[model samples]
Target chain A: MKTLDCLGRRCPVPVIELAKALPNLEVGDLIEVLSDDPASANDIPAWCRMRGQGFEGGSAPSYLVRRLS
Target chain B: MSYGQSVPPTTNLDSASGLPLHPAAREALLTAVDEGWADPSRLYASARRARQLLDGSRAAVASVLGARPEEITFTSSGTSALYEGVRGLASARARVGRHVVHSAVEHSAVLHAVASLDTSVVGVQRSGAVVASEFAAAVREDTAFGCLLAASHEVGTLQPVADVAERVGSVPLLVDACQLVGRAAVPAGWSVLAASARKWGGPTGVGVLAVRTGVRFAPGWPEDEHQHGRWPGPPPLPLLLASAVALEAAVMESAQEDVRLRGLVDRIRAAVATIPDVEVVGDPVSRLPHLVTFSCLYVDGESLVRALDAEGFEVSSGSSCTSSSLEPSHVLVAMGVLSHGNIRVSLSRTTTADDVDRFLGVLPGIVADLRAQAGV
Candidate 1:
């Protein structure tokens, strides 16, 4: 599990942080992002889909995802 | 003549709010209703009472803008405030220079003013933010002023105002904070700042212009005596009171609302991304909390907006601002991005979670419907 803390952050901050962190993850690795912005709930999942990765689950203030092969 | 009336939906999922007016703000407006009619500048006793309300309002607005009371002047609208500020700077600094520099993605008001200026404009990347170094390179020794917005109104991409200030060096920096003030704090070192009360929470027809002391300008060209003759005539006291109250309300709730709205905008980007042939515009990470924008390929933005409106959504498109001319959004066009079917969702402090969920629920379906109808 690789973690990127983006709590209290807004758009593109969480998005940018995740983009930077994505490369470090191996196949099937987990990337967790903590954020309070409502958009992150949808943004991370969409980002994962765009990159062909898997987004697991998250509540407001916390988001978790898995990187896929 | 016999057709039945079709009313619009009260819940605007496409808007930043479920309700047009936030409860607290509405209450504030009501509790202080009496002050709404008083004239702050007149010599009558009632005017004195109005003056108290006006002073407090000015102080409240000044607090959010990070400027002194003497520096702040109220205007009728955001567009007018920006025009006046840009023009004032251009006129005041003409002795020192005749050239002006502004980001390519500036608001229409700024762009129009720039068009009116005898100066050059520096274009920006598709991200809608000017390259700071490139902007600095564009400035000449005879540069009269430099103008930069706190953020792009259409795309919601934030500009590095402080960095731009540094780039301006000795030149005056006219900062358009219309989309930024009350949501994000103004960056320090601006020579002049402008904003609209409506963009935050105040009523329309109230704009703010804050000029730092000692900046000289030609006041007679389009002079108003309102703000030290920089603007003319007596100010609108009721609207100013409303503006101040709205500013205070926004300041109080901004942190929490920003968090909520950011999430909402992010969700919008995510949900919209699921649809085929959709491209979300702007810097994904570096945007305002309460705004998000996107475009659909090969679709007309006006039609998309009308479709959304028909589906109980009250949203706007950057395309509509250019509706009459049928030109694409300058913000999107400047970014060299797609301009078709562009829509901008801007939130108010009154926005709700349910409201966003409703929008997310309706948006993809609306897009799908439009796509099907367009046969794309």
Candidate 2:
């Protein structure tokens, strides 16, 4: 699992980092984002859904994702 | 129709933010400002005249809403009415149950008003309308109060207020009709309801709250003789009268305007979808006729709004970046939709077909430009 630290960040920044980080990992690799920003909780999952990546759930400040394509 | 301004902006598509006072309201206010200046509570001759205007105002607003004049209480604003509606019902039913139930997409006013109570927020579909079964399941026999919006202020989706009300049994419901009063008929089966005058091209300082005759309510504010102890002090009689006049005119023209605005909105929805990576949201079929919302991938709302303003169009946005709070709109999040790069364009009686056509032409370029700048 790879962890992207987005703590102390505001909206768009955290999701932007997540989008940027997802492309570098292997197809099956798992990634988690550490974001205190409230919008990230929903935006990250929505991004995965929109981009065809896998969303393995995690709570606020710790959203887990999987690289798929 | 003029505010005595020298230069009017090119076009305004943000009527939902608050319509500038209606021409009718403006005309009424010009005369009422002097005639309504006296205290309606006093016994003087001028005071009696003010009292007559205030009474007539309530009766006029109530007639348009299908409510009785005495049932209406003019609150300081729509938010205050929600507080009075929710808390008063719960306060009156203190022994019944502490449980309050509402749709998750309710306005922050309802959410804030119910913060102190035990509450259940029922989830909604992607289109932002609540499933009646799910909503009914959340209501308990002991539930003190329930709330639902007549239509979404953000997405303009209409809720199943009537169906949910039918299944909730005897629990008193507070229908927040702020977005529906003048746009369409407020679905029946509410024990109490609240609406904003500003949404219908009325003056800012007025909100109408109507309680059905049988519904029990304790005054949420410090008990006062004014407004049936529901609100404090005498309301701004002139503006309140103007708000009533605005609502009467709005409701009268709503049916014809409904078709006209919906045609323009459909054009916007179809036009917006052609843009790359854009998502037009809200219920396509079941929504307010004049409003449409959409989100552009990777484009921040403020940038999109600023760019549109530069192009001489004005609209509203719910994306996180536009707000000082830095939180995405709860309505969008609740619908599990994109929260960034959002715009809400709501038309009005003054918005012409030419205005919408001009907007549709510029919008795609605006989104594309913002997205390209972000390298998305």
Candidate 3:
């Protein structure tokens, strides 16, 4: 399990951090994202769909995901 | 026409926001201020002359839009037109039910108009085109009004308005043509239609609403003789005259302009796809002739717009960071696509090939540099 805190950052920033951190994680590893930006709520899940990663459900300011690709 | 800006000439790639006033419109606007200064609704000689000019303007706009003169009502703006069209249609159908149906990709004006009503929003696909079958299934017996855009205001994706109109039988549909008027063929079968004049190189603060002759629309505003009893107070004569002239002129030239601009937008779409980590949004084929939107990963939309503006190109963004409301663009959110670093470049009627060539030459480097700065 890994945690990425992007509490104060705006969108694309939180999503960018998520993308950057995801590469280092092995397949099936869990990455929990903490983003306060409103766009991040939907953008993180959208990023997962576009990037071919698994998006496990979680709410705003906190989304849980696992690396699939 | 110059406003005394320091720069020579900045390329305006934000025409979706509004095009520069049409040449015909500018001429009409200057002449109208002096010629149409009197109160048009009065019986006096000067007022009578103003009344004739107003009627002529309405007739001109009607001929261009394929509607009757009596059917057209000029509102304060495109948003106002949408409000009037939406509220009026819904009011008349109050006996039916409170339910309304609209596409998820519809402009915010439509969304806000139906906020209080029982609404069912039909979602769109990745290309921003609404699923036709899904839209048809949403229309129910109690549905009072069905709202759909002729084309998307943001992504430029052309909607299957004709199909949806056919499917939503007996449910009066209000078509918002704010994005495609004077640029594309209007899909028929709308009981009511609304559009903004600035969209077709007309002045701001002028909008058009055309209700079909037999459509059962109850005026939602207070009782007033102005604007065919649809709105209150005297109309803005000069602005409306200019808007009509611009719409007429643009429609006359639309076919030729569409082909030329479509070629330019294609060049933009193809070139934009070459940029690394960039996903060009919207339907490539069934889109507006002059607009293209693309998103770059690991980049901020506002920062990208600033960089583009600094490079002598003005563009717009739909990302949440670009809006004062801080909410992501509902259009993008509905499409379920990446909302990162989006740039919407729309070409005006005056945009030359050289302008596009210049933009293409610099866009890649800008995106690459921004990505590097973010260390992505």
Candidate 4:
């Protein structure tokens, strides 16, 4: 599992960071992202849906995503 | 009639910044420029005539604002008036305490003034209106002053000033009326009020500040004996007179224009909501009659504003994420609304139905095109 810390950063920043981190991981690898931006609560999931990836919901302020491709 | 049937009017609708200069105010200003050159403080004949005009202008402004002439003073601009009012009140009541309480969505002028003092910011509701209870709770015994806008300039949500005033008890409340004055009846129960002349059809460079009787207010700086020593130096007699005339005319036209604008704003609010991934912010029913704000997902606000301007429609965007400003709009962030692709439409007295219809007709296609290009 790869962990990306995006706490205290707002939208587009966190999503952008997540995008940058995902390319480093192989298929079936999971990335755990931590962000406090309120928009990320919806943005992460929306981004996953748009990119056709797996979004495994996590606790508040933390998101879990799986590399499906 | 559908929008395509008739050509849209040529008038642009970006009145929140300032309205077009009224003809009456223009004439008044030209006349005063010729006659109001003398120093009102001097005892000469021309000076005395200038003094009369200045005093009469103050009285006219006071009459419309429901304040006494003794309590009103003109400043260089609305931001200056706000600084004077906030700093003066805070300093006057310093012994009470240096703490100031204000809503999170106040104008930048008020926010900057509060930043110098120990400040408590009450959160606002999603509707963009301040939560009265939260605001009341933030007002402490040590609070020297409290500030609330009569209306939100960005989103046009009306604040509960009267209720917050009652809740704060004796704590003086400074109401920024830049958007409220000349558009709606001035709400009572504020200790001080400040407004900009250009927000109505008056020329810029005139800001009015009124301190209610019995409020403890000390000038922020040393000043001459003009404006009860609150504002220093000689006043702008011609601009003051023109501002008074413009305010009165706007007030007289407000009642009828309110009905017309409200209908148009309602049309906008309803139509804007129908667009994909767009959120119409602000109180749907309790907002100002002529202003509406909506934010689109997956689009940059500045780009959208530029695209609309290219279509011959003028509008303002509040998203601080614009290229010029990296920080998102504090008002939207406070309200937990999307801070991207935001557009604030403020209708002036001259905005026509054709303008609104044309904007509505063109907006959907623009948004669709932008979203497609962005691959959202």
Candidate 5:
């Protein structure tokens, strides 16, 4: 599992960073995004849904996403 | 005379702010300034004459708004009218509740007025419109005031004001009709309404607030009894008369201009959709006839606006990341649309088909260049 620290970053930046980092990881690999942006709570899941990735729900400030394709 | 036929097109196209003074409105302003230069509140001969002119202007404004003369009060600007209207309505209904419910897409004036209150923000649909059911659900028994725009200034999506008013029965619905008043008929059943003069090609420094008869409202502060206690200061007589004249003219021209601008907007919508990675936001059919908004993926919004401006097409953008203000447009965010690279094109009565064609001709290349520079 790779942890992408996005603390203190705003929307589109955190999401865009996550998208760029996702290609580096192989399928079935897990990534956890640590973000303080309140928008990330909704945006991360929305991005995952749009991109056909697995969004495992997270505790506050940390969203765990898995590469599916 | 029609604005399109009488006024020649300018070299630079301005579709950003609807502040251009109409020719008839300008003439009215000049006439009023010469004739109405007295305090109408006094009882002297000149004051009596000014009072008559003021009353006549008020009646003219009231006639176009479907409001009574006593119900309409002119204010300094549209924002001030909204501030006074929202605060007054909230204060009057304090016995019932202190909570205010408004859609996330409401104009800044409404949002700022409700900021200090216990606000319950209703979300909007992806089309930049508030879902009537969702808005109704957000209204609690404690909701003292309800606010909904007649139409969005940014995306031009018309809200279901009548439906929401019906659902939130008994709550005072303060409809900010700034964008819709002169463009279309103000829908019935709103308890309070506000509009700006400059939005309808009238002069600046004048706004109108109409509180329906029987709606309980309290002024925000203690002041001399002017404007039925809604606005305290002496009103601008000339500007008030000009506002009435402009509104009457704009309302008369709106129906014909609506059809023409709808065709121009349809052209922009169809042409923009053909561009790769462009998402046109707002309801296609149930939207303002002269406005359209679209977002380009991976392109900076400010860059796009500037590039369009450089090509003689003035437009406005609402992207969060493109400017100093990092907060995204609450309307776009609530709608879950792309928040970056967003551009809003709002047409006025003077906008011509050639102006729109010029904009459309240069838009695709502008977006492609921006995207290419961004390496997206």
Candidate 6:
């Protein structure tokens, strides 16, 4: 499990954060993202889909997802 | 005048139409035409049925705009409603005072209407906001009415309505809620409100105008008994229903969608900021969640918008689209910011993180290409 802090970051930063975290871990690893920008709620899920990963929903202030090979 | 229908051969990022219906509005439009095409202003049973649909739409729109059903009058477009609203207010408030005060950042509709009136437009700071204190200081005791947008359409900056209203003393506030209605909750204090249905995922040709309970509105036309004779036009039942449905849908889904759009905007902001010579306009925290605008120095905005369009992205530009005119956007110019190579990206409920990523992935290359071509 790799936890990345993307809080208070705007567009492309959260995506960049996920991209950096993904290459370091094995397949099926859980990654957590904390964001304050409202758009990230939708952007992250869409990012996961584009990357061929799965997004489990999260409560506000945080989001959880898993990497798939 | 006939509206032309030509489809561009690329992905559209235009927030004006919102993300191309996503099955709900598209499906609704197909059936709504069949079920709601009857003339709503007639006296027959079928007309009464159409009237019911119109009434339902009114209630729904009123609910979202924070006004009563009796106060709302539907018009063909937001421009028409604003023309009517300003004209009506000018007539009604003329006795009190003939002067109208508006923000420097208003839409062309509002600005055009004010141009025809005895009006004064208050300017903004470098941050794209019309200061409440400056606006109040500009108003005289003889000033009758005022108008301002809750959020600007071009730069996406919000106005200080409640504070401005407090400073204005007793003048009525007309809020152009076109950009902010569905995206955020409106602050209480406006006496009149207007918004375009298309801005929030509804069909075009439908606009909502809400006049507060106590404000006086004298219709400009010699009219009969429709919409209190305030606006004199036949209402489109199908479009109204579609507008109502879309507004309600936005309200239901806004909390989640807003958060999502803000995130994408933030990401774009961060990426764009890292590039030197890029100036991102608008207030970073106090603006709309789904919209962000940036102006690149030493580049033509139209060329940038066109380049992005060619690359499968549909975005809007502050650059004048009319032919042979080289005037920059009044919004950017007023804020004393860069005027060329400016683009405004807005998101809708249908927009996904993938769309933002695709936009981000393609945008840097497009800007770099345009810069290389311009020899910047």
Best by DockQ: 3
Per-model TM values vs. the true structure? 0.78, 0.92, 0.94, 0.86, 0.88, 0.78
Question: Which stretches in model 1 have alpha-carbon errors above 4 Å?
Answer: A1-69, B1-8, B13-45, B221-226, B320-322
lDDT of 3 by residue, B1-376 (tens): 7786686358999999988899999999999898899998788998987898799988988886678999999998899999999899888999999999999988888888999999998889989988878998998889998999989878999999888889887888899999888889888878899989999989999889999998889976677777757877888888988998898888888889999999999999899888876888999999889889988888899989998888899999999889988888888888877787998999888999999999999899889989999988
TM-score for candidate 6 (chain B): 0.91
lDDT of 1 by residue, B1-376 (tens): 6568776554453332222444455665665576556556668887788778777888888877888888888878888888888778877787777788888788878888778666677787767888888888888888898888888778889888888788678788888888887777678868988888777767777789888888765553345445677677777776677678777877888888888889888888898888776788888888788888887654557777777777667777765323666354667767756565678888776667777778788777777776666544
B1-376 per-residue lDDT for model 6 (tens digits): 5468564446555685444443455566676688777777778887787788888889988887778899899887788888888877888888888888898889889988878677888998767899899988878777778888889888788899889988887788888888887789986788888888888888888788788888888876668666667767566667778888888888888999888888988998998876656778899988888888987654556777777777678888775432245455778767766555678888776667787778888777777876666444
Docking class of 2: medium
Candidate number with the higher lDDT (2 or 6): 2
Candidate 5 lDDT, tens digit per residue, B195-276?
A: 9999888899999889999999997655675676688778999898888889889888988988988998899899999998
The per-residue C-alpha lDDT of model 6 at residue A46 equals 52
Give the Å error, residue B158, model 1. Answer: 0.3
| Model 5 collision count | 0
DockQ-best of 2 and 3: 3
Give each model's whole-structure lDDT: 0.74, 0.88, 0.88, 0.86, 0.83, 0.77
* Poorly placed runs, candidate 3 (over 4 Å): B1-8, B41-48
Q: Top TM-score: which candidate number?
A: 3
| Residue range B1-376, candidate 4, lDDT tens digits | 5666644345577799878788889999999999999999888999998998899889988887789999899998889999999988988999999999999999999998888799999988889888888898997889999999999999999999999999898999999999888888788888999999999889999999999999999976566778767888888999998998898888888899999999999999899989977888899888778999998776767778888987888899886556355666788778777676789999998888988999999999998887776655
* Native-to-model Cα distance after best TM-score fit, residue B177 in candidate 6, in Å: 0.9
Give per-residue CA lDDT, model 6, range A1-69, as digits (tens): 667887776533565567667777778878888876544564466556545777888844588888787
Predicted candidate 2 versus true structure: per-residue lDDT over B35-132, tens digit per residue: 99999989999999999999999999888778889999999789888888987898899999899999989999999989999999999898999999
Ranking by DockQ, best first?
3, 2, 5, 4, 1, 6
- Off by more than 4 A, model 2: A1-9, A17-30, A67-69, B1-10, B41-48, B221-225
